[model samples]
Target: MRKIFTTIVAGLLFAVPFTAMAQVNILACEPEWAALAEEIGGPKISAFSATHARQDPHHIRARPSLIAKARRADLIICSGAGLEVGWLPILLQKSGPQVQPNALGHVTASHYVPLLDTGAGVDRSMGDVHPEGNPHIHLNPHHILPIAAQITDRLAQLDSANADYYQNRYQDFAQRWQQALAQWEAKAAPLKGTQVVVHHKSFSYLIDWLQLRAIASLEPKPGIPPTSSHLESLLQQLKATPAKLILRTPYEPEAASLWLSSKTNIPALVLPYTIGGVAEAGDLFALYDATLALLLENANVE
Candidate 1:
């Protein structure tokens, strides 16, 4: 009887440490935020992204599996400013109070960054224009540290015991990220003032950061699919000004950009707009590396 008692107590002691190591659950609205959370939270958190590289953040459906994840989430991270307007509200409604809007557990990356394309004259006629500005803020590497700071604060608040761990992680990530940013800027020097056309405004932040000029978009308006008439107009416009390259995300249909490229002799390139968008862009640093390499390869620098 004493031997049996000793064995049971030993088993219970062994299980205690595993139970104590339970991770905080994070439901990130996009893959970039999930990757960012992983950087800050390290092994103390389990981060999951609702949208993948090929999925359009603007149009995701709030499916039942997502609702299940939301219910279990200790925190939620997203790029706000109406980027996830289609489904985030529904997820918030079904999620715990901790992750509701304005809650400490709810972190919006855009709220911490200076947004573009804001102000009056926004209407449905504008075709999916975000009144709060462009939410593709992750494309600008400079915007990352601020958002990482915010995330670290939230992680500390959520799990005070691991606060120092998160802070140390953020500091290390910041140092490496800053070094990468400088290198990227130096390598991209030749791309400044280089004119290009785009399938959409998806890379506005990237273009703005690199000082590249966007001559035209395949789409006539935001979120609108390209039409024959609009493409013909863009063809005429480019004939006069002559853009160096045409850009599009992996998820975007290639028809419009390809058609334009065939006529103009300008190369159409697909940029991995987020983490996992391309095989090479497996992480945040790699995302910028791949982007700059692609631009430099095709750029007509003097």
Candidate 2:
């Protein structure tokens, strides 16, 4: 019995270092990054998102709990390009230098992906335009692979002991993601050049990827709320071109899209903009699946 107890204690002591190094705490700014971290980090990491799918990423406040999460995080992953400009700076300021910008522990998805709608000479009058570019890069499925790769590198850098484990999981995720992309592309083939009116420029990357034409935005400018006069102008403009649907993310107010739909005779569609944006968008894979399915359903392309 003494030898048996000694052997068990020895095994546990040997496992201590590995066990301590296994769990990495990742703080993602949004649900998409949280989902991607789960895909790459697998069981080796614990991921937490600051914002949910149904929340507006732009206007979120830096709560105390988020500050606590940032302080304890092994790495911080965010969309960057000024998407979280409102609150991330406050969180970083409070969390200290561990997850500051340009640090290895701080990873921004925008740094990995090629951004669109850049150099538009944006100003404060433009209403929340990202000077770095459209920060909604996650809407593009093509950007996911590079972001995932960058995240994997960061994971390995912060937790070198689990480097091989992270890489293996990333490779597997990459394979499955590529396969899923092919399926999404095939499914969304009919949506190419489909004209749509959007609430914001948030879906720019998705529209670009699917070859959808964005005729008008309900919000006259990015992040600006739709006004009666602006909607009137948009309605007049869209009538000439005839957009098939008026689209908005789950977080966006439905009134404007619904009003536009009623005025224009176009259906208003709420896209599952990210993980958990809709009941069907429970994860990254389901996110795209639900988005494309909704687009096809509304496009009337049977």
Each model's TM-score, in the order given?
0.92, 0.93
* Candidate 1 TM-score, true structure as reference: 0.92
Tens-digit lDDT track of model 1 for 171-218? 999999999999999999989999999998889899999999998999
Model 1, global lDDT? 0.89
RMSD of each: 3.1, 2.1
lDDT of 2 by residue, 233-283 (tens): 888888788998899998999999999899889999999899998998988
RMSD of 1: 3.1
Off by over 4 Å in 2: 1-20
Residue 128 accuracy (lDDT) in model 1: 55
Positional deviation of 29 in candidate 1, in angstroms? Answer: 1.0
